[model samples]
Target: MNKPEDAPRAFQQAWNGHDMQALGDLFHADATFVNRFGRQVRGVSAIIEMHAPIHSTIYSDSTLENELISVTPIGDDAAVLHSWSRLACGPAHPAGPHVIDTLFQAVLTRRDGAWKIIALANVTLADPRTGRAMLRV
Candidate 1:
């Protein structure tokens, strides 16, 4: 499989499964993650911690759908990628099972023959009605 596409697909699977450990495993030890909330988490351990609460609460039943926009190879070992995505949130969300459009980006590097995400960022699209980010600030 193509590593560039495979990596994020695995991430999406882990997220849909609510498996924080597997999600954290996809990131490098010193990886950085920025969420739609604008908070940043550094390091895999911290990243896991950052996701635990969300996975057990608001985003508990969320699933991801991402379409790869581009994958730019930086060398045999690294690449940057972007995707158009949506988070389908279930009953736990106030709106209930609505999908939120998002833009995703990541930088991945090969370590020990496996691609690991070094940086990840998710941006929420603006609400068509209000012209402001769909996510609460």
Candidate 2:
């Protein structure tokens, strides 16, 4: 049993490692995820399904560098996390090789003595050159 502050750090480690199973396990059964692309995926199972292919194909060799901005506890069972991450897509990516940074916010809940992500939302930081969104999540 880790402290509440470790939850987001653990998630970032799992994500950077491209461990889908571990990542999925960090979400509550009824968790929901939203991306900057306006896509919403609900439930832990659905979240797993949504990320399976992504983990296998696109992010097979990707690396994520995260900077946790804040973690605010909302009662004893829940917390909100604000973060920024730099994503470096590997050669396996279909969109070609590139690196981008994105800002994200997530709501996490402690259920059954474990910290799980309940809701997540993200948006790209924007590109300075073209003034366009760089990352989708």
Candidate 3:
């Protein structure tokens, strides 16, 4: 069982490795994911289906700059993690991926001694200059 602090590293590693299954493994079976667009995707399976293609395309060369904001303990077997991340493209980006500043919250529960994300919500910060979406979403 990994500590709650392990989630961010796991997430970053999965994204950087471009491994969909590994990424999905971080979530619980009944997990719900809310994207920056406000669409709610329920279940880990649904999240994988939706993200696989996007990750292969616009975000293929993206890397996350993640900062752990806080971890609040809900009980002995549950916790909520708050994090902020900036998704940016590397030199190999196909068409210059949009840079996005995102804030996310994840609710994790200990299942069989392992922590799994049960819910996640991502909010993209608007561009202060343009007052519009910071990323292509």
Indicate which candidate wins on lDDT. Answer: 1
For model 2, how does the per-residue alpha-carbon lDDT over 47-133 read when each residue is reduced to its tens digit? Answer: 778877887898888888777788899999888888887878889998878887877788888877887788988777777799786
Using TM-score as the yardstick, the better of models 1 and 2 is: 1
What are the C-alpha RMSDs, in order, of all predicted structures? 3.4, 3.1, 3.3
In model 2, the clashing pairs are none
lDDT of 3 at 1: 27
How well is each residue in 8-58 modelled by candidate 3, as lDDT tens digits? 888888888889999899999999999988999988889999889978877
Model 1 agreement with the true structure over 27-53: per-residue lDDT tens digits: 999999999878998999999999988
Error at 69, model 2, angstroms = 0.3
lDDT of 2 at 23: 80
Off by over 4 Å in 1: 127-130, 133-137
Pairs that collide in candidate 1 are: none
Error of 1 at 77 (Å): 0.9
Candidate lDDT (C-alpha), each = 0.87, 0.79, 0.85
Candidate with the greatest TM-score versus the true structure: 1
Superposition error at 109 for model 1 (Å): 0.4
